[model samples]
Target chain A: MKRLTRSAQRALDRYLHTLRTCLTGSNAIDAHEVEHDVLGHIEQELSECREPIAWARLQIVLDRLGSPLMWVPEHDLPSWKQLLLRLRIGPEDWRLAYASFALWMLAVVALLAAYEPIALGALLGSFVTARAARAFGGELDQSDRSKRWLTEPALATAALVLGGAVLLSVLPAMALVSRELVEIDTLRLQFPSVYHISQRLVAVFERPVSWGWIRSALLHGGPWLLLPLGAWWLVLGGIARWRPRWFAITFSPGRPNCAARVGRLLMIAGALVIGTGVAIGLVKTLSIAI
Target chain B: MKPRKDLRPEKWTTQLRKGVLELCVLNVIATGRLYGYEIAKRLSALSEPTVREGTVYPILSRLKQEGLLEATIEASSEGPPRKYFALTAHGRRRLRHMNAAWDLLDDNLKTLRRRTAP
Candidate 1:
């Protein structure tokens, strides 16, 4: 016989006492039956344990077996299926949050592109910076307190500051670029090659017939574009609250499966190249008639 | 199984719990060489409050892997013959070294705390 330690013996004694209570109780007939079933289950587990049972060790085993809930008729405890479902929680929720973020970004791009292509580009640069902050914020782990920025307001503040700085930097540069592009378009109108190329490209889309129309396009489209982005931000924030690490994994690029991702990128690039080539060829044919 | 997110984390007080196996195995063998269950029970008594399936076996496997312990089959009545663990000379030396280090660490912590006190 493998001698049990005093502590192990004590734990077992407590367990047996609980078991006895469950089985021998004078109350419910069902409780007594359940006790017999529980004893059989416990015996099966103990037999498989292969080692001598100690008091403390026994308690751990019992806990793992889910504390063997008492057979209460009215309690709202989760069923086995529910418990299993809770444990098998998927990353779908995080993926939905990420899709929301991507949509938000597209909305912002639409806004900026309408306001001023250059300013839109600048806003894009800022958005990229904001994204970096979010990535770092998401990487924070619970086991390591020092890394958690949510609890430390200073870290969050720092990230916000950096993101804002990026946005500010991009905006002015975009405005300057847009102004220069407008000025250059005016000066180049008299040059045959420049004018022809510009006219061909310009004709591909519905031209803004007047400068006023251009200004109106910018003003009207700008805020409307940001709506999706705002929604995305809210969705991402919600996801982060639900399961921070999963949210990070869903949004953060440069994930482990980079090779498969590269294949997708290559396919998209090929399609874009083909489309651009066809567009240029069509413009050339249209210009020849002119 | 994933730990419950809502419950308070369990606090293990003693430093020995950090490397409970080496010490516990040594303590168990101090009487006589015994099998896996015997050693696990002894350790569970002193600390662990509970032991379970697959827990002690890993520690035993680790000790054997490190060459501090060796296992051999012994006749038993409960089931199949049991695999008992005994400390090698190397194991005994390691236990001594671990004990010395633990003592040194404990003493330093105490001294530092005492000095820092107001």
Candidate 2:
């Protein structure tokens, strides 16, 4: 029932823009209902506040709604569908990313359990080599926002590789220490139950410090990787902003001559293959040695 | 207590809005579907000349979603194609029911005012 203030009208308009960005559809009816509900809630709260306090209360309400920029409209569910189409993220391709992740995890577990030192070393070498190649190659040349190293193919490969490496190294050490601890404990069973020093060492191996090393590697190497990635993003952003046509031609799906798409697939495949080879080698070594 | 100068205008506007918006919207949609801009223009012509175009869309969307009205897009010879809305059979029944209720209420209020007149 309250008449919207000029500022409230402006806020609603801004919220609508982000909702449209998140969702595209012929019917904005659902989104509009949400906006009305939000605005009405603010109005109701403002009415309850003292005259002087109303303005600040209204601002607080808006702040709680978050950056009106981030409101995803319930109606605009088509945006994800559109993006998936534009990115050529077919069901098969999406399934492949999931499958690849699962395979990498399985390989890491197998290598750690088998404990073949030489093969494990080769796996690490191959993984490092693939990552280095992808890094040195123009593959990492994507923009910072676009590439997002934490989730990107290269980083995932690096993580998988590192996880395998640590597991391979420490699992054997853990087994040896555990064996020594048990032996020591049994020998001193009759005497004052003496604790084995190797038990402490084994405890150290079991700690998640192995992944800590991986995290450290990422933190150290991230910026160097991100710099080129950021530059790539800036360049891509510039292209998208100013010359969207050119950008689309180079990057959009189904373009026969689009070097960017072909380049991306080739680079990602190369990295994954190299990473997998490294993992397999590590597993083989771990299997033979231990 | 005397009201502040600024508060008086806002209070009156809110009162006017509370009284009229649903009736205004129903009247506008009585004939046929018109996109938000047209509805705002028609509402503005009835009273305040500066009706905010932004306010109408939410009401229209709400009404459509409420199943009182159905909306669809048709090609326009003008700019972009506009979303046209029409009252459903349910909406017509509801509107007719409300209109009758309002008439009875209005009649009772008038009768009460007359009997109490000084």
Index of the highest-DockQ prediction:
2
Task: Kindly list the per-residue Cα lDDT of model 2 for residues B1-118, writing each as its tens digit.
Answer: 9998647987678556635566668768988877655675577567663334344555666577778888777766644445676888888887888889889998999999999999
**After TM-score superposition, what is the CA distance of residue A159 in candidate 1 from its true location, in Å?**
53
Per-residue lDDT tens digits for candidate 2, residues A220-262, read: 3222222333344444444445554564332331222343544
lDDT of 1 by residue, A54-114 (tens): 5455555566433222222112223553354334222221332343345345545666667
Clashing pairs in 1: A8-A54, A8-A55, A56-B49, A56-B50, A56-B51, A57-B50, A57-B51, A104-A228, A104-A229, A118-A174
lDDT scores of the candidates, listed in order:
0.46, 0.49
Give the TM-score of chain B in candidate 2. Answer: 0.82
The interface root-mean-square deviations, each candidate in sequence, come to 14.6, 11.0
Using lDDT as the measure, the top candidate is: 2
Q: Name the weakest run of 10 consecutive residues (lDDT summed) in model 1 chain A.
A: A67-76
